[model samples]
Target: MVVERDELLDESCRGAAPLPQEADRVRLDLPRRDDLPDIMYLANNHRIAANLATMPHPFSLEDAKALVQKAEAAHGNSAFFAIRLRTTGRFIGVARYANVEEGMPVHVGYWLGEPFWGQGFATEAVHALVDHAFTHGTMDELTAACRVTNPASRRVLVKSGFQYRDQSMIRSLGAGGSVPIERYNLERAIWKSLRTWGRVAS
Candidate 1:
């Protein structure tokens, strides 16, 4: 389930940190051109698009191509991963983190296909991404937001060590208007403490 060679993103990741981060049941790696059809199929649903701020409903193959293209051109300041099953190599969703400029707080975001909801995959993928951010980068904290109506996403953030910050509004292309969202933040110090506590408990 790994790319033998990823020229698109490899240069950006070299000497910085590792890619294809692994979780208990999933792997996070750069999306490929081959993933276009699957991405188009899974992302075209209204349910998935409504929860995300930028994704539009009726996501077509061209949109999927654009997504992979965007990932290829990210240039290491950001990382976009295609969440896939380790065993089956099935494209299930997407996850990413980015900052508007250096030294600013990076924002993490993710979305799973509708059929994959309620399976805990989202939490696992998020944990993998969070660990990568705090472990390999200098950011002191990461931020996230979910549509107010999306309890599942909110729970995923909580379960991954993010604390509720405040409420905000963002335009959702799928929803066709502005939507209320609940913001959350996870400090690197808190994340480290949680990891230590988990180790002690285990």
Candidate 2:
């Protein structure tokens, strides 16, 4: 079922008061008007643009605005968050869960600005989002995909507990070329087991 914004907010806020403290690492709050410029700059960088499917080669303010609007319009079945450093409040990247098909699985994707690529922030942010999805939503599994050549992204997904599934050739919507992509997934049961294993190991 498609989740509406009001419903998501209501559900997200239920039983828990909104925290007043600044987010020490990552926050999933709604994107704001001021974030457009930075979002475009980071998203359009050559390295990041090459990794993503839909990011334009030269991302413009218009592209950022359009993305923000689409993100806002999308409710139940998908949600997007602007990744920012808590202290600086600068846009580092974007992460999202979408294509939540019933009886199937929900998919997630994300990118980090080149400057933030090696910081482990992507893994942390994705882990939090995965926790939120499994705890708050009904999906039984989560999946993600990345360009086959991008080992950095693959490492992040592995650190977040996703297992490599298989590879497929898909048309790149951004680069306008057919590219091979590797898929990965983690079922809720497996995720739970892995967490337990980690606790025991520690």
Per-model lDDT: 0.77, 0.65
Name the weakest run of 10 consecutive residues (lDDT summed) in model 2. Answer: 1-10
TM-score of 1: 0.88
lDDT for predicted candidate 2 compared with the true structure: 0.65
Model 1 steric clash pairs = none
Which numbered prediction scores highest in TM-score against the true structure? 1
> Which segments of model 2 are wrong by more than 4 Å?
1-24, 100-103, 198-202
lDDT for 88 (candidate 1): 93
Q: Which residue pairs come into collision in candidate 2?
A: 3-76, 3-77
For residues 179-202, what per-residue lDDT tens digits would candidate 1 score against the true structure? 888888899999999898772121
Give the deviation of candidate 2 from the true structure as CA RMSD: 6.0
Candidate 1 error regions (>4 Å): 1-16, 74-77, 101-103, 199-202
Candidate 2 structure quality by residue, lDDT tens digits, 38-76? 888777776676666666778888878866655554344
